[model samples]
Target chain A: DVKVTQSSRYLVKRTGEKVFLECVQDMDHENMFWYRQDPGLGLRLIYFSYDVKMKEKGDIPEGYSVSREKKERFSLILESASTNQTSMYLCASSFYGETYEQYFGPGTRLTVT
Target chain B: ELKVEQNPLFLSMQEGKNYTIYCNYSTTSDRLYWYRQDPGKSLESLFVLLSNGAVKQEGRLMASLDTKARLSTLHITAAVHDLSATYFCAVSVAGNQFYFGTGTSLTVIP
Candidate 1:
């Protein structure tokens, strides 16, 4: 069984605060992703890391960035949070190549006040 | 650029009813996946359709894919309350990135 754990399940932050959400996977997956899910919008990818120190932007990467200093951990950073950034953040990881069936973490519910 | 769209964004049906949720993508891809997400929880992978004409089923849910049509269908048989959740279909592009749909939120009434 694969386990993906997030640093925080629920977080509250004020506007313009720098927020950090961390994810760690035990399966040693090479690909890690960050997505923010909103009502009606579903899951929009923020950023993804294919390997240590490698990252790429996804459909909705504005106001967000990512860090992958190690293989087992991936971090999502909101340089400056806003009220509109309040949503559920999901982290997922998968093996390299074609079989991209992801394993997701419990998710972080961030509330930007 | 790839786009994924799901039909009937909100579905409300009876417990014994049968329904199908459609997922359409705007690109050519052979690998597609179906996932279910309960409220306040993360998504769980349901099926992975890897080829055209591929069909997979578990319990009362069946997922089929058509690569040529760039479409996938998740059918629910005799739906139950336990099956109520947001269903999303994603297409694997370039053997790496996955583009997910807006999701279909299902509500099963008793």
Candidate 2:
């Protein structure tokens, strides 16, 4: 079975705090993605990595950054947590050259106060 | 930029009813995907339609894609309470980035 795991199911952080959300996939996929989901706004991509040490900014990557030190692990970082950053964060992984059928993790609900 | 839109942002139906959710994209893409997300949970991949006139069915759900029209439809034959969730349609434009719709929250009442 394909599995994707997130570091935290729920997190609370104060403003200006640095936060890290980790995601690991057992499927050995080459593509990893981070997205924040908001009500009515849907899931907006924050960042995606195609390979180790290779990352690309997505549509809404202003307040977020990502790192891919290893093939199976992808991390999303918030340099300074803010109230507007409170949302459900999701991580997904997919094959390198396939149709990009992504498998998602359970998600992390981050509350910035 | 690619834009994906889903109509009937919310749907409420009784058990054993039938309905369809529409997904339309603003760009030209042949790859479309449907996902289901329960409340406070992660999303699950439901269907992947990669070509024009592609139709896939699983249990009580069916999905079809029309690439020329940039449209996709998810049809529920007999909806049960288990089918209640938020359904999102995503389109892959040219690369790895995917555009997701606003999603349709479906509630099936028994």
Candidate 3:
């Protein structure tokens, strides 16, 4: 089975601290995505990478950035963590043409204090 | 912009009951996806509807899509304790990005 792994399952950060969430896929998928899931808003995409070193902003990308240094690893960066950024972060990976079926990581629940 | 909306943000049903979750999108899309996520867990893919009038079923759950109307429905035939989870419908646009619905939280009581 295809597997997507996140570096951390739970994290706590101080308000103004820089944070990083990493994701790696074993399937070598071309597309990688970062999303923040909230209670009422569901999952809102923060950023997505279609290829190495390529990134695009999704619907809600205000406080987040992403890096795709290699084909299998994608990282989400929080420039400065804030209280509003506390949410469950999900990472997903899929093949180049197949966007309908994405394999998701276990998710990282970040708490900004 | 693509917008996906799901109806009945919260649903509670008794065992052996039947219900359906509705998903609607704003624009035409090539495919629609259904996913289930338990509390504090990642999402699990359920079904992928590719064309209009496409229907896919697994066990007691059935998903159908109508591309013309940009709507999809996930119908649960019989409620069970293990089937309780949040269901989300997503639409794929421009080949690489997907827009997810707000999600429906389903709870089944015995």
Candidate 4:
């Protein structure tokens, strides 16, 4: 079975705090992505990595960054957490060549206070 | 930039009723996907339509893609409470990059 795991199911952070959300996939996929889900706005991509040490910004990557030190792990970082950043974050992984069909993790619901 | 749109952002139906959710993309793309997300949970891949006139069905749900029209439809037959969830359609314009629609929240009332 394909599995994707997130570091936290729910997280609480204070304003200005640095936060890291980790995602790991056991399927050995080459593509990983991060998206934030907000009501009425849907899921907006934050960042994605196609390979180790290779990352690209998505449509809404202004306040976020990503790290891919290893093939199995992709991390999303918030340099300064703000209340407006509170939302459900989803991580997904897919094959390098086939990026359309992706498997998603359980998601991390982050609350920035 | 690619944009995906879903109509009737909210849908409410009784048990044993039928309905359909429409997903439309702004640009040309043959790869499309449908996902179901339960409340407070992650999304699960439901269908992947890669070509024109591709139709896939599982249990009570059926999905069809019309690449020429840049449209996809998810049809629900005799929906039950268990089918209640948020449905999202996504389109891929490039390798590993997708644009998701606004999503449709469906509630199957008993």
Candidate 5:
């Protein structure tokens, strides 16, 4: 079984504070993704990394960035958290090719006040 | 812009009934996936349809894809309360990237 774990299951931060959400996968997958899920809007991609030090912006990347310094870990960074940034953050990983089914971690519900 | 859309955003049905959730994508892609997410939990991969006319089933849930139509269907047979969850369909694009639908929240009333 593949295991994807997040650093935090819940978090709270004040406005303009820096926040980091971390994800680690044991499957050694090459592709990692960050997504924010909101009610009615579903899961929107924020950023993705294909390889170490390689990152790409997804549809909703504003105010957020990602780091992939190692193959097993991916981190999502909020430059300065705002109330609007409060969301359930999900991290997923998949193999580079063939099957692209993503394995998701337990999400982090971030609250910004 | 690439888009993946699912219909009947909210569904309520009685146990033992049948229903299907539809997923439509805006681009041409042969690989589609189905996932189930329980409340307050991560998503669990359900099915992967790799080509047109591909179908996969597990227990009460079945998923099929039609590449030409850019659509996928998740059919629930004899719906059970345990089957209630938010279902999402995703289409693979540019090889590694995926566009996910808004999801269909299903509730099976006992």
Candidate 6:
């Protein structure tokens, strides 16, 4: 089974503070993604990395950035956290080819106050 | 750009009842996925429909994809309380990125 682990399950930060959410996958997948799940809006992609040091902006990449220094780890960074940034963040990873199924992390519920 | 939409944003059904959630997407796609998510939790993979008329079943849930129509359906038979969760359908156009539907929130009441 594939396992995706997030650094924090819950986090609280004040406004204008920088926040980091970490995700690691044991399967050594080549694709990693960051998404924010919201009510009614569903899961919106924030950023995705296809390979180490390669990143692409998704539909909702504003106010957020990502890092993929290694194949197993992907990081989401909030340059300046705001109250609007509070949401459940999810990390996912998939293999290099064939299947597009992404294994997701447990998710981190971030609260920006 | 690929867009995925789900109908009947909210559904409430009794145990042993049957219902289907609809997912429609724009443009062509070779891969469609179904996922279940509990409140404040991550998504759980349910089905991966890869081709037209592709169908996959697990437990009381069955997912079917019609690539020609750009639609997918998730049917629930004799749903139980444990099946109460938000179901989402996602479409992968380029086999790289997935666009998720708005999601269908289902509640199974006894």
Please give, for residues B1-110, the per-residue lDDT of candidate 2 as tens digits.
67899988999999999999999999998899999999989999999999999999999999999998899999998899999999999998665778899999999999
Error of 5 at A80 (Å): 0.6
Off by over 4 Å in 3: none
Show model 4 residue runs off by greater than 4 Å: A97-99
* i-RMSD values for every candidate model: 0.8, 0.9, 1.3, 1.3, 0.7, 0.7
Per-model TM-score of chain B: 0.99, 0.97, 0.97, 0.97, 0.98, 0.97
User: Model 3, B1-110: lDDT tens per residue?
Assistant: 77899998999999899999999999989699999999999999999888899999999899999998888999999889899999999998886788899999999999
Sort order, DockQ high to low: 5, 6, 2, 1, 4, 3
Interface RMSD of 6: 0.7
Model 6 CAPRI rating? high
lDDT of 5 by residue, B2-93 (tens): 88999999999999999999999999998999999999999999998888999999999999999998889999999999998999999998
- Ranked by lDDT, the better of candidates 1 and 3 is 1
- Fraction of native Cα contacts reproduced by each candidate: 0.69, 0.78, 0.75, 0.81, 0.75, 0.72
Provide candidate 4's TM-score on chain A.
0.96
- For residue A84, give model 4's deviation from the true position in Å: 1.2
lDDT tens readout by residue for model 3, A1-113: 98999999999999999999999999978899999999999899999999999999998999888999999999999999999999999999999554447889999999999
Question: What's the number of clashes in each of the models?
Answer: 0, 0, 0, 0, 0, 0
Runs with alpha carbons beyond 4 Å of true place in candidate 1: none
